[model samples]
Target: MKIFGHRGYALRYPENTLVSFQAAVDAGADGIETDVHLTRDGVLVLTHDEEISRVSSGHGLCKDMTYEELLALDFGSWKDPRFTGERIPTLDQLLDLLEDTSLILNLEVKMGFPYYPGIEEKLLEKIRARNFLSRIIFSSFNHYSVAKIKALEPAALVAPLYMEALYEPYHYAETFGAGAIHPQAGLVEKSIVDACHEKNIAVNLWTVNRTEDALKAQDLGVDAIITDCPLELITALRS
Candidate 1:
């Protein structure tokens, strides 16, 4: 199974920062999973929440702040003194960093509350401009967004992320032309995996940091496991 670092080695470095993503690459992750939000200026930035106060020194909704306003806040200092100056990274910055690597990017479009208008089109436009559309997997809890992505680019690898257990999720994903399904790790069963595989859909579970959970995912024939500690999980799984 492919191992994807959740928010880039988030267990070690500040989540969604460039350092964390690079650390995930150095730790030998096959892919990187991150959240994306649009700034007030329409710049796509890598951050997990609409509110920046949790991860940075700034206090406010990310959508309310311009890219220039966000640059002034210390995104890394809250995590550690060593990462004090780590600024919030843009989608362009991340794509540039991953240009030479064969890592798939699971870009989760953050669009629930405080939604950004026309985010799907903007994101697709940026990826197409960068010529990086083939390596991205667009996912979101909003199934509409996933459908929008597939409609925008028929070849785009779109996945619907759901925390609740859906009845026959493979069918749900298929209805929207999704190639993959990202469900909470605890909600996955062997039957679900089998059903998904039978329909030629990939199953990628999230936040699987425990060894037992990782082992279970491997046994169930999952396509990928997203975890916060990639290095530790890689070592444990190999051993």
Candidate 2:
């Protein structure tokens, strides 16, 4: 199974920052997963929450803040003093950074809670320009967003994320032409994995940090495992 960094070895570095992503690459993660939000100035930025308060020194919805306004916030200090200078990175910046690597880019469109109109088009445009359609996986809690992505680009890969089990999820993926299903790590089971595999739908579990859990998912024959500590998981898997 492939191992992806959940927000870039998130346990050791600030999640979704450039340094964190570099750490993931240095630690030998196969890929790095990140969340995306469109700033008020129409710049796509990496961040998990709709609000900047959780990850940075700023207090406002990301959609309400311009990219310039967000640059002033200290995105890393909330996690550690040494990482105090880490700033939020635009998606363009991140793509430029990783364009040369073989690392898979899993972009979780942050459409839950607050929806951004035309974000699908914006994201699609950038990925197409970067010619990353083959390497990137677009995932979201909104199934409609997942559908939109597939509709936008026939060659684009999409995985719908779910916290709760859906009725016949493998079929759901097939109906939407999704390449994979991203379910919560705790929500995964051998039966679901089996069902998904039978339909040739890859199962990528999310937010798993424990070594035992990663091993279990591997034994279950899931396609990939997403974790906050890719460094530790990579070492554990190798050992």
Q: What is the lDDT of candidate 2?
A: 0.91
RMSD of each: 0.7, 1.0
Scored by lDDT, model 1 comes in at 0.94
Model 1 off-target regions past 4 Å? none
lDDT of residue 188 for candidate 2: 69
lDDT of 1 by residue, 45-159 (tens): 9999899999999899989999999999999989899999899999999999999999999999998998888999999999999998999999999889989989989989999
What is the TM-score (0 to 1) of candidate 1? 0.98
User: Candidate 1: RMSD over Cα atoms?
Assistant: 0.7
lDDT of 2 by residue, 1-239 (tens): 99999998799899999999999999898988999999988999999999889999989999999999999999999999999989999998888878889999999999977889999999999998889888999999998998999998988889999999788889889998998999998776788889988888999999888999998999888899999999898899997
Instruction: State in Å the error of residue 80, model 2.
Output: 0.7
